[model samples]
Target: MSIIIRKSLLELIFSGAFMKRWNDKLRPMELVEVDKQAHKMIVAWLLFLLNSRDLDVVRKRALGESLIEGGLFDYLYRLVITDIKPPVFYKIKENPDDYSTLTNWVIKQLRPRIMPLGDDFMNRMTAYLMQPEDKGLARRILHAAHLYASYSEFKLLKSINRMDHELIEIEESFIERLNSMRDLVGVSELLDEDSNVLGGFARMCGRLRFQKRWSQTPRVPETSVLGHMFIVATYSWFFSMEVGACRARCQNNFFSGLFHDLPELLTRDIISPVKGSSQEIGELIHEYEIRELNRVVLAPLKEGGYEDIAKRLEYLLGLEVGSEFKASVNMDGTIVEATEEQMAGEYNIDTIDPKDGPLLKVSDSLAAYIEAHTALKNGISSGQLHHALYRISNRYNETPVIAGVQVSALLADFD
Candidate 1:
């Protein structure tokens, strides 16, 4: 069965941008749901790496997929049920019947977007949320990631919170949550928050919140690299499913979109124009990013006994293929570009570790187009943004349906 690319689904994911976090208290910087989800996933990945080194590769990938799906389930649920406070939501959750009714409504709204992934995925989302209990490693990792992300927000608002009467109770709740997750692997160090190893990873990702996209241009609800990454990752998963990508390919595509711009964290978000000014400059920038990624991020993790995570990162970033936009498969110890037929055929299996790079690239471009389209629609006009929207729209118009996504139609919705 083929999946249709629906504007509603894409819009639903982008809706996160408008969702303000900690709305009750003032914050130094804008806190948005999309960026928080991205930060949480990053922390979750680090925790996954630390805890799963001894696990088999199959289980490791399954765990990763579980976290991604489960995290999205929670995110989508929160998106619609936005008005309720956390305490109130938990109270409702305690009543299984109430939780089920509300969660079922959420599932119903999301079904058109999610059922394409298959019945199993739908079942998992319902079960994960409905259980409302510790569901083992994947759930623990999700909870810890959620807590760490919230705590990061808390730290930022600490000074502001100091003046608020409810700050103490909120702070104590965070402390209690952290204490509860101390038993989680690699989470104990996060308790220190300032000097610990896991905290360092979280901080680096958190800093991305400060690095807003299109800095030269203004937009309502300015998005961060972290938020943009989350949108792309979400889009990639949706696109991957539409293309009937295998489980490995789908997960690979999603994570690749998530981390594709991670090197930008090291080099800053160098605009495409500047990067493409000259072949020499583009290659030079690429070489620099690769060097820095290995030196600062990867080597340290590998040395710290996280070689598997480092290796996977290298693969996802297309260090071997020279670009993450190229479809690829690991074949006989070498990463090789694979054709559509090959991907749909023998390479679909998880053992080969296929990645739908081309699909990810489409998702990446869609995210960018939405960003520009969103700004323009919000009345923040600029030559650069218009040019971006025009370029992307025309590109898809020229060759619509990239990797099974109906690109032209999706763009039409913005018109």
Candidate 2:
């Protein structure tokens, strides 16, 4: 159902006490014109808040002080001075003091929610926003981030559809930048300590094909995050394309790969055998994962009144609880019965041809090679790798596979 949020209603929504008192109240069918504009502006503001590195609300709250000198005035001035048109400037100017008051009030209210984020991270995010040319693009990216945080994958489809081409492109570019962040040493390090953890986790998820090897390593290995993500993104894209899925679906598949490993950040990459011993053990481990993650990764954000990062991850992965995680069972001395799905939904691209199923098959093959390569790098035997390769070639012989030949060619890389 559609909710028509207006100014008066928004004031209530923004009011912490008021919102709590009428938690069940919903918006009506109609909105005043001013209210509609208000809605758009608020949406835009939220979009800006989420996507931009500048507004580190969580970090600011966590630090227990305003990092920016002018408080909300500093924020509004930054907004207006950076790419805001003359009319928007005039609107701000007409009631400058009132706007300042409203903005400060909003920030004060939000500060409680964002304080857990810490000051250091908040400063960096604000600095990113201070860059002039990035303003419009930043807003779009922030909007996508916010929508993703609030809704489901399907909701992302709707959100993107509702955006104008310019905004969509802006958001896409932003996402691309985020995808590429792991390639840089500074960015990867910064993300580990701050808000870009989402991006860092995405890169890890995309790299899941390298799991056993990655787990065995002392750490992620400085540039391994980039290397793994490239592999997953490439495989996901190739697989979806061969299947004839639409570009959008293919993109989502790539994103799915990117997000697959996020929970590992919180849970510390539990190996499959351990997780599969029993349901109770698994649940206990799951709870520990959430607790540790909140303490290490999300507790900082809690100071700012933000929701649980693990809970946000549950929404992203589309699971009600962590019980749905994949398990790998050792069937015999060199055989493993492994089943895995990173997200709740089926891994199918509607626009792609059914024949493209081979792409998924290829992704699996490439992942195996990455594991083998990593294992070999660490001086492990290639026996398991060879066994997996044998399984795939054997499957192809039994059925005609799309891009079967191309995939076979790529398998040579594993060897």
Candidate achieving the largest TM-score: 1
Candidate 2: count of backbone clashes, pairs at least 3 residues apart or interchain = 29
What are the per-residue Cα lDDT tens digits for candidate 2 across 223-288? 232233333433554345444444334443443333444456555556544776798888788777
- Candidate-wise lDDT, in order: 0.83, 0.37
lDDT of 1 by residue, 114-142 (tens): 66567776787877777777668988898
Instruction: Provide the lDDT at 293 for model 2.
Output: 55
**How well does candidate 1 match the true structure in TM-score terms?**
0.93
lDDT of 2: 0.37
Give candidate 2 regions above 4 Å deviation.
Answer: 1-49, 52-230, 273-287, 290-312, 321-365, 373-415
- Global CA lDDT computed for model 1: 0.83
Please state the error at residue 362 of candidate 1 in Å: 0.6
RMSD over all Cα atoms, model 2: 22.5
User: TM-score of every model?
Assistant: 0.93, 0.35
